[model samples]
Every structure is written in structure tokens, then in C-alpha cells.
Target: MPTTTALPPSVLISEVGPRDGLQSVSRTMPTAAKLAWIDALHGAGLREIEVCSFVPAKLLPQMADAAEVVRHALGKPGLTVMALVPNLRGAEAALAAGVHKLTLPVSASAAHSLANVRKTREQMIEEIRNIAALRDERAPGVKIEAGISTAFGCTIQGAVAEDDVIWMAEQAIAAGADESGLSDTTGMANPAQVQRLFKRLRAALGEHAGAAHMHNTRGLGLANCLAAYEAGVRTFDASQGGLGGCPYAPGASGNVVTEDLVFMFESMGVDTGVDLGRLAAGRAALANGLPGEPLYGMTPEAGLTKGFVYANGRRPATERLLAPLAP
Candidate 1:
């Protein structure tokens, strides 16, 4: 393998398969299989992985073993262990489990907020504030990201106002979040809308702008991701095998597929530091853990383009033609 330069990875692909992906599925993956799947994701060079959410077991039984999964992920050297926290209690639990990053979902659509988190937008802001305070008290090192779900449009609320999305991101920052990002909760975002809103988010929050979580329900997942990139978003939340959807987000589908997302960037001469071959192996683990789950993603089905060379491969991007990995 060629030594990658010291330059930071051009994009950060945050694997959300273990958390968002699993939660959407019906089966409760055994703790061991989840651990194995996470290891595979790490092996594929994903530096960050959301291992699970800290919701109550009765509400989301799939994530009942959040602590154990976090514990296992914590052992990975140089890996950022992340988890979702819907409230202060969830934040506390995630902090206790030693997560390095916390993503708190605060819906942008008023109706979605009430339906998803059982709180108004104001209440969710309060939760973000309290969670930030708790993080400072116990684990000052843990970074908090306030994710503004339904930032584009909500199935329940119809269309989320662009101003409201900006306001939510700004408020989240003022409420003590280290960063605030946008999510297309209902998968209703178009490329233009994605770029426009992200530009506004960056303007409102500046350096605190975070990840883009887009869904592929309407088949614009990759395009929307590209639009966000053009708008300066460098962190993205994707799932292996395209496995994720918000249970509360009626009619929404899977998230941007990790394999496809990685390929998109790498093919564009942007280094994502992810190995598609290894990502496929991770998908295999996902299938083995929960048989009969319908996986999605085009790259996984259409073989890599001939002469495909990863952006971080031996040759520099300018000189590299796509080269297949040696068998």
C-alpha cells in the first residue's frame, strides 16, 4: 500500500449503519454481530462511526445494547466513537459509555419535532443545552453536534421554511452545541435546496456547521450530497448497504449508501480514506447478522468502473487513471 500524505482526509464519511441503519430495521442484531460489523466499518477506514442511539430499550429495542457497542468501539485506535442522543438522559448514558462525539437530533419542522421526539422545537433546544452542560460536567472532551432533522421538508409539515432551518441551526449553536448540521428527514430535498440551505446554515453557524444526512427515497441522495459538498459540508452520515430511515419520518427511505458515497467522492478526485472493497465486506457482515434485509446502493451492484483508482491510491489524483486493486 502507498503511504497517504499527512494531509487530512478531504471528506469525512461518518458511518451510521450501526445506529441509524439498525434502528430502522426490524431485527435486533446480536451485540456480537454489531461489534463485528463495526469493526469491519473501522477496517474500511471510516474514522467515525455512530455505534448506536441511547433511546429507552422499550422504545427502540434494537439499540438496547448501546453501552456494550460503544465500549467495543472505544477500543479502536484513532476511531471516533459517536452515538445519537435524543434527550439529556440519552446524552448522559452515551457519555458514561465513553462516546467521543454526540449527535442530538433537533427537528426543524415543528410538527416533526413533536412527533419524533415528543417535544416542541423549543424543548429540543433545551435538551441540547442540558446535554451540553452534562458533557462539560462529566466529559468535557466529548463533542456535541445538534442535527436539525427535517431541514429540507417534512412529510408531516409539508415544506420546512428555509428560514426555519437556518434558525434551528443558529439556535442549536447558541444553545451550546459544538456544531449543527442538516438532515433531509423525509428525503424530500432537491440538489438546489440542499445547496441553498447548507449555504445558509454555514453562514448562520460558520465553523459550527456539521454533517449532511440525506436519504435516497426519491433517488437524489448522491446529488444532494454533492450539492452539500459544493456548499462546503465536508462531513456526511451514510450507512453501509444504504441501510437507514427515520421510523417517524413517514415515507422516507434509506440514507446515502456508504459504498456509493465513498465512490462518488473518490471518483471525483476527493480522498475519503475509505476502501470500497472493505466496505463491501462490512455489508456482508450486515447481511449475515440480519438475513433477508433488503440492501440498496448502485455501486455495489454495478461493478467499479474499469481502471478505477481510489483518490488516495499510489498515484496522485492528477496522474491517476482508475486502476483496479490487484487480486
Candidate 2:
């Protein structure tokens, strides 16, 4: 029960590499490799995965295999397969693909919304309502998550108002979104902002509030996640090897590194239910799956240190042998 006392009794780290990670990279991972990587991640004890975004193939050729990936993920037992859908059509495609969860990004900043999705804030809310209604009528059990991107600030439009983010969350929840959470789209979030926003979101939306999706643009991704955890947020969205960034936002690092985050929490006696050694193995699978794609993360390259005890037992032999080499 290390995590029980050190951190929340339980935490869910949602892997976003398949969707968010690959989308940002230029090379397309073959469908078979992507499937194998997903299998490896699940074997490492990752329960939820954002497999792909259900957008127009013409727009993001990388995600053209979203339906195939979704189908593959669904075949894995106890795995929660999630997909990003920009509009009602994408949502329909996602549901038809039998994904367990669907997330739609709704920007809090009007300018960012218009730039990213070509819709105003209100129009995005309406889209969520329509999608929710569609899900209710068609796939009653598929979970809908509203990812409020640019909840902190935007690169194009700086200093996004917190009130605006909270209002958007309210509107999405009111429109029947199963859950809503904030995304640091521009990587402009700080620890204080993350703590405050998540605290307010949980207070407003209660259990329907989702995770903290952060980027390491300023190297504060892990810090922001810790702040959210302190504010009672358990679920986190991360990518293997930190592979993901906003194409629209310059200088933003990839998603928080799954290996490092797991190490941070588990090292502090927090149980993430993720085996760090196995997680690294999963990352290797990821690399092999998409060769030539640049992967990011400190822990993977630096390796684990001595006396690192995982929640299950002593550090695996592979990790012990590969301890961080002398700098």
C-alpha cells in the first residue's frame, strides 16, 4: 500500500502515444506495429489508451488507421480504448469502431477555438451536445470525455481567462458530456494554475471531471500533474517516451513522459499499478514499432537508479543492470 499512503490509493495514467504521440510525428507507424505496441503497453499494466483520432484522413493521414486500431484495441480484454473525435462524424466513426471512450477538444479561448477547430466556443458546446445525444441514442455505454484544451493559456492568444475555461466545462457537462477535464494545450500552464483549475473543476463538475492533460513545454509537466494530484485529480494523460506536441503551438514539448511519471510516483512509494521496467519495455516496443521516429523522456535514457523498489517487488533485473550510467 505504498501508493495508498504516498499518493491516491489508485491512479489511472491514460497513454496517449498512439493518438497524440504519433499524430505529431511525420512517419506513419504501420498498423501491425501499432497493434503490437498497444499490446506491449497493456502488458505493462496500462489500462486506458488513446488509440487514435477519428478525423478526416485527408486532414491527418497519420490517423487514417484509427478505425483499424480501434478494432484491434477493442479485442484486448479489459483495455479501455479511447479515440479523439473533432466533430459528430468523427464521433460516429469512433462509436462504430467500438471504442470504449471518446474525447473531443474544446478550446476555452475563442481565438484558439476558431484557429484550431474552426468553431466558436458556443458552437463547440453545441457540437458536444449533439455528440452526447447521438451517443445516448446509439451507444449508451460508450463514455464521452470533453478535453478543454487551452484551458490554461494559448500561444496565439496569451493569458486565457480561467473563468472562460470553467464556463466551458460547465457547458459541456450540462450538455451531457460524461466527463470534462482541462488540457494545457499550449504548454503555458504552471503548477499554481493547474492546482487552481483542477480544484475548481472538481468542485464544479464533481466525479464527472476527468484528468490533467499536460505538456512539458517548460519542463513543468510532472510538476503540474503533481499539483493536480494534490488537488484530488487521479487520472493523468501521458505518452510513452514523451512523444507528442501541439503542431499549432511552437516550442511545446511532447506529452508528459510515462516512464518518468511512473518512476516519480512509484519512487515516492506511490503505486501507479504500472511496472516501470515493463513500462520501459513497452517504450522499446514503441520505438521498434515506429522506427526512425524521435522518442523523448529522461527516465528512459537515464535509466532507473539503484535501490529502486517497484510496488510489486525489487526492481527487475533488466532495470538493475541498466541503472543510469555515469554522466
Candidate 3:
């Protein structure tokens, strides 16, 4: 019998605040402020960030400057700039903007597919194929990530089948996605369900399985993320200040907060390569960009545990222990 390898002590937290967090809000963050926020996140040790979406401005005005934002993100050293695309058209724009990775969300729930992308599950898979082909032709180096939204369950249809989620992941892989992953778009997942599904997803997709995108709507976001991590997931998608939700998924709140997620891993002796103090300071951009927007996080509010140490050696011990007291 073969022994299972232990999960890595460090995890990659892919910041999605600019794209996911900003999209759900009504106010559009100015491009300058968005760039500042991205810089701050990068300064805090984040390597990957979903800068913006390539959808039309008319549909989501908040992302009207997607191209500009992507360009700015690309200028950051060592940053893997990611952009979300709804279809091939959006993919083309993202490619032109020189994104390092492209995330294409395909709804696992039929009702969500129709409501969110106006396409059936099958049709979205076809779009994935088209986008993959385009990526190969134009930007073969860029990675294509198929994010299966509403994989946990849907508000409209309810009770999304586990089989369907697995099937969709397989289809995305077959359709040319570099990797496929599950998303708790509706925030209806529990720790047990997350562990089970991520295990199944890894079994099905193997190394091609992608990041875990969890929402904190039901207050189980961090728990669900930990479950996925225990189930062999390494990359996580989180938003600063827990500010995002699917417009089509009713009652869906922001994603798992980055500050809290980092605190969880760093406190557990797992390295997330993020500095809590700098990450907390980065929130100033969030506050400045979207004033009055409710930000949520435990660490940001309570501050890091006394004598906390980051897994990475980016911050000195004295600096690490001197995190600003939360107000």
C-alpha cells in the first residue's frame, strides 16, 4: 500500500478582491485606486491576483477598466496577473491585455448557467472549448482555469448533484481547460461537503484540479477552505475584506476574507507567503477605493495572536510581532 504524501505546509492565496469583490458592488473603483490596491497586495506578498473581468462595461460598469487594470497588474514584478472571462470574446480581450492566467467560470447548475451566463451547462462547456482553442492560437503560454460556479448548491434550482459537478470538471478538462476547480458560488457548502467534494474532484481531475473558491455567506467559508486544504487543495481564492458575491446567486455574500484566511494558515504554522500586518495595511486601499463598504475579517478586527510568525521569512520577527492593534 502506498502512503499518501502530506499536504504542503504553505498554500497560495490568490487574491480576487479586485475582480470578484468589486464586481458585486455598485460603486466602480477608479482605475488609479485599483492599481494602488493591487500594488499594496503585491507588496504584502501576494503573487497572484485576479485583477478584473473582461465583460462589457455596459453589463458590469465596475469592471469597465479591465484592460487598464490588467496592464497595470502585469507591470508588477513576480505577480501572476489573472483576469476572469465569460466567453471567448472576453478571453481575447484578456489575452490582448497580457494576463498571465484566465479564469472562465462555468456554472454547474443549469439554473445558474442560464441566469449568470445566459447559457446552458452544455453551451458553457462549448464556450470553454472555443476559448481554449483561442488561447492556444493566440496565447499558448497563458493558463486557462475553468471555475465551476455553484458547484455546492444553487439558490434557484437547489441541491446540485455531486455527479454533475464532477462531470462538469471532466468536461472542462476535456474541452481544453488547463485546470478545473469547484466554487461555492452560493456559499451553501459545509466543511464535510467541501472535503468530500474536493476529494472527489481531485480524484477525478488529479493534478489538473484547481483552486478552491469559497464564500463566507453562511459563516463557514474558512471552515470549508480548511476542508479543501486538508483534501489536497493548495491554491485558494479569497477577497480582501470579504467583499464579493455572484450577482445571479441570491443571498450569496463576499468570498472568504484574505486577511482571515492568511491568519488561519500562518497561525497554524502553515505559510501563505503573506504578511498580516502589510495585508491589514493594504485594506486602506479598500477603504479608500470603496468608502462605506462593509469589510469583514477576524484577524483584521482582533489583530494577530501575540508573537505570531509568518511562515515566509519576508518579515523580521520584530516586525511580525509589532502588527498594528486592530481598532
Off by over 4 Å in 1: 1-9, 247-253, 315-327
lDDT of 1 by residue, 128-148 (tens): 889988988999999999889
lDDT of 2 by residue, 1-327 (tens): 355534336688999989999998877888888998898889888999999999998989989999999988988888999999999999999999988899999999999999988999999999999999999999999999999998999878899998999999999999989899899988888999899999999999999999899889888999999999999998999998888866334444668988888878777766788877667667777778776566667787776777677764556666531222122
lDDT of the candidates, in the order given: 0.87, 0.86, 0.87
Candidate with the larger lDDT of 1 and 2: 1
Cα lDDT over the full model 2: 0.86
Clashes of 2: 2
Deviation of model 1 at 127, angstroms: 0.9
Tens digit of lDDT per residue, candidate 3, span 110-145? 998999779999999999899989889998999999
Give the worst 10-residue stretch by lDDT in candidate 3.
Answer: 317-326
Candidates in order, TM-scores: namely: 0.92, 0.92, 0.92
What lDDT score goes with residue 161 in model 3? Answer: 95
Among the numbered candidates, top lDDT falls to 3
